[model samples]
Target chain A: MSNTLTPVLSGRADSPRLAWVLKRPELGVGGLAVVAMVVIGSINPAFWDAANLFSLLRANVITGILALGVMIVMLSGGIDVSFPAFAIAAMYLTIKGMIALGYDGVVLPFAVATMIGLLLGLINGLFVYGLRMIPLIVTLGTGTAVRGLLLGAVGSSQINIDRMPPALIGFGRLEFLRSVGGGNGLSTMVVLYAALAVMVHLMLRHTLIGRSIFALGGSEEAARRAGFNVRTTIFFIYGMAGALAGCTGLLHGSMIWVANPRDMVGIELDVIAAVVLGGTSIFGGRGSVMGTMLGVFTLVLLTNSLIIMHIDTTWQRIVTGSIVILAAAATSWRDRRIAA
Target chain B: MTATPARRMLALRPRRVDPALVQMAALAVVVFILMASLNPQRFLRPYVFDSITYMAPELGLLSIAMMLTMLSGGIDLSVIGLANLAGILAGLFFHATAGASGPDLRHAGAAVLCGGIGIAVTAGIVGGAINGLLITRARVTPILATIGSGQIFTGIALVLTGGPAIVGFPGAWSAIGNGRVLGVAAPLVIFIVIAGTIGGLLTRTPFGLSLKLIGTNTRAATFSGLRTGRTVLLSYILSGTLAATAGILLSARTNAAKSDYGISYLLQAVLIAVLGGTNPAGGRGSVWGVTLALFALMLLSSGLQLMRFSNFLVDFIWGAFLLLSIALNALRQRRR
Candidate 1:
């Protein structure tokens, strides 16, 4: 785990296979995903259909982006349940603002949503740092307040497709590699998620701020002693999370063509599970963008395949929860063995 | 000059009175006064009091359950889900024995009531044990573990109900929810007994002492030869039992059970637990503090309802209250 946290300039000069397997824990999740995909595809011919594949990829868009954000926060040893609230608030509010301003441009709406999210995330950073309270409690407080305020004071009504901005909806509907009759094509969201994943990966691996976040997660005291501005870094991490959530929320609403105040309820646990499943340590200071994305992919595949296999959709929650418990237990058992 | 007065007050401060409980007591009084003044006729009526007592027990039990977990340096986010699952299972029990059809409760005997309630209690025990095993034996983080189990519990409930409220409990069964014991709500009486028993368990037992020690410092407790794992596991089981009792009460009150009933109670329970001075980081809380906080919030919300405030506004206030209390606790600790 410690080796994974630090940058590895050179590979271990031991028997390459075992060393490589041990070094990249995320490969396990990827392998599991592949196996599950193959088993499901074999069981159900529809699983390999382009339409099914595109829809599954589409389903992963918002959640995958959220998982990437959460991966960053978890790397800093904080758990945030408030991102979903902030995401919906940003999305609903942004759409409402666009409607009021009679503005329909895609880029501006996204920028405004991102800014709103950044502001909300900064507030979380402030509370967590200023109050010196647990992240879970603080975020719970803010999340509830924001959700309450959004639904109560702002407006609880759904902004349906009838009222949505035309350009924004158009952007959401954009796709590449379309069939002649437009029966199957990849959603623009897939591209958006991929691009964001790459950007996050580069930022986390190649930037000083990203290193500081890892250091902070490893040990706040150590990071402080090592000349890191822990406060700014904390603020940056939360701000980034919020910004991503905000951006993703608007994208989600645009893709669905509806901005419901109650959208994205109960997504916190799922996103957290995905990030954890991806080989990110729940304790923080050990995660990667690729791992988090793979985690999301695996989770999306597992749940989506349940439907393809003619299983009850309600079983999805039970399956996801079981996976979370099993994964966490496995991680703990492995860590204990190492300690011994 | 201000520092001198503050220092003098601190010197005179007695170690016996808990400031958090006292604060809650004062807040309760203030809220009572404000509500009374705002609508003397409506707020001071027996009907309002009866309704408050009626509604407070389930949430009150939940807060107590949450407080117990917090006292041991952990939390159980699954209580609400566990409660719903318990209720659904018990509801299924009534459907099985008494029959689910309308006005056909001929088999609604004392035996049936007991059986239904027993089933709910058993569900709680099993659910709590799973959570306990996960946190203790499997070494999963309490929050993550509970979150996962909560989903599983809710999912099971959903599968059983298939997306609709299960109605038709025996008249006697629902009487527990709506019936009065000597002019007091039955649920209120049940709440008092359970809260009192749990309070006594926490204050006057070796188990309580062990819990406090563990929460304050688990390593020290472990070194001192305390059974930390066993104690935590027991606490979770107890928490689950309490939540299940609340579930039965809820089902009885509504005369129906559903997978997603009382969804908002989860956060409200957390709010009440924290407001009651249960430290989220673990250790240092009380059943009495929780009861007082519950009364205060109930009074505040009831009053606000009289003033035509929406439920969402009440939620916002609850969240604000949680944050404010956390900040106050931080300030108090810093001062010490």
Candidate 2:
């Protein structure tokens, strides 16, 4: 709207009252999520069951990780729809490599796949920073390229897994929250998600680099004048996103126990919806990892409840889409009102 | 003496250049040459022309819709979804009135077909109005608003038929989609007429001029007393209607309507529009440029299929090409 190629991701941090409200958007959204849960649980007692929560957490694993990655990108005043492609490509290549190379080892395969993902993200960073292109277009192009590569080359042979790397299977089955869910416990993947969330939360709150990211999102010129290396910060943001995507891909493949090529193709929308709905401003500098965490849970819970209610799955998209728009509109409107 | 004569000849000649036109012409040449070399047999045939003509209209129309929206500094992500919903609605009408699995649907007559077409177009227009309302009235960003509406439309479509294809149109409906007028597919003819009319609207009409002004600077336009909101709303309505028409054509030709019809078209439409040189930031584009882009892509894709290349391969090329061209476009802007 302002003639800036990147439509502002976050709101300005200068407004005292507005910034306070913006920074604390999660409280409102989180409350709504709780309300929805209570209402839905009353409607269907099964919705409150531990099994449902366990499965919901499992489903949230991929989206939760993706939200963390997207939060970083969005905070930096950019968007990355390319991460699903990154994850898919990374996982596909890893799966293919395992079969073709017969690598029984855990660390090597994942390391190679993640490096590839990082490389892909670096490409996005270069296009956005060096070429000075819009982040959406840069990532869109790269994302499509990665998807094309996956479909063109390794996509034809979807390998069914008879055996997984010892590490993956071990990671998948390990139970956390042993006291909950009727002995099924919380999944290892969900546990991993919590750990990652804490790590990201700390990074965003305490670290100088994290603070600079917010500054950059608020305004690049100001960030530059404040002595932040804008390009390096952006590059790192995209790279970090890519690395996270790769990790998620491995987890996905492990959970399914099959290297299905078509997996995670259109899931970017869900991830984005979750993050944005969680109260992350599309125009950056106002959001939190914890908020994103709540957003992911909100989405998962909504979808789960709909299924339990026997509502057509098609309605999920409608709801998700509406939530995204309403969240964004409310934020934008509030920001405008505050600015005025 | 020879050098003097050569220098004189070079200096005497006048130079003329139109960069946009030159770029478009060059793209056409490149696509033609690639196609001709790769699958000379089929591409060299007259039938291939018909095939290209047949496929071009639906895609071409969607691109025009996107281009128009982008020209106004907005986007309509809901077009494909809207189109499908419109088609599905039409299908429901025909199915209820005439019955499914009917014999020789062509004999269902022009009146019935006209009604079906009208419903689709009207639904499209209505959908567009909603999108416009959301943006202008609600203050939602174009992208997010359209996306939300798109989801709603898709949900409705699925609910209408429960995620199944709606079949059973009269045989005559296919004639409109597949038949020829002066050896040209009717859809192609419709496309040309639509393109010509819209082209005129953008360049010749006051509405078009005002829309452009609005896109270039909304605040300034508003200050000048232009009804910026109304203009945006009309642009979206036009887009929605066009997408609906495309949907009608698609369903008529395929003889079915489904929620997933042209599912891949959303991104492809945007790609083609951008490739046509519609400025994503808005306030710059040309109908001829978009038309040429449509032609080039049609050729490249059709040719690749003729050569037995996988669908994924073409997608790859398109993505890279869009990226490359955008990069080049930016570089050129920098140079200027």
Best by DockQ: 1
Q: Chain A vs. true chain A, TM-score per candidate?
A: 0.93, 0.90
TM-score values for chain B across all models: 0.94, 0.92
**Tens digit of per-residue lDDT, candidate 2, span A230-336:** 88898889998998998788878887777776678667777877887777776778788988998898888887689788787878877877777777777676556
Query: In model 2, which regions exceed 4 Å deviation?
Result: A1-22, B1-18, B104-106
Evaluate candidate 2 and give its CAPRI docking class based on DockQ.
medium
For model 1, residues A1-340, the per-residue Cα lDDT tens digits are 2234233324333545545554466877777788888899999988888888888899999999999889999899998999999999999999999999998899989999999999999998988898898888888888999999999999999999999999999999998768832587889789889999999998988989989988998899999999999999989999999999999999999999999999898899889889878877777777888888888988989987887899989888888887778767755654454334
Model 2 Cα lDDT, one tens digit per residue, B1-336: 223323432432324443665687799889899889877878888877778888889888998998899888888888988889988998888777677765635467678788888899999999999889888988877876787788778878988988889887777777768888997799999999999999999877767877777677677667667789999999999999999988988987888889878866766777778777777777777788889888888888888888888887777777787788778788878899
In candidate 2, residue B228 scores what lDDT? 91
Candidate 1 lDDT: 0.87
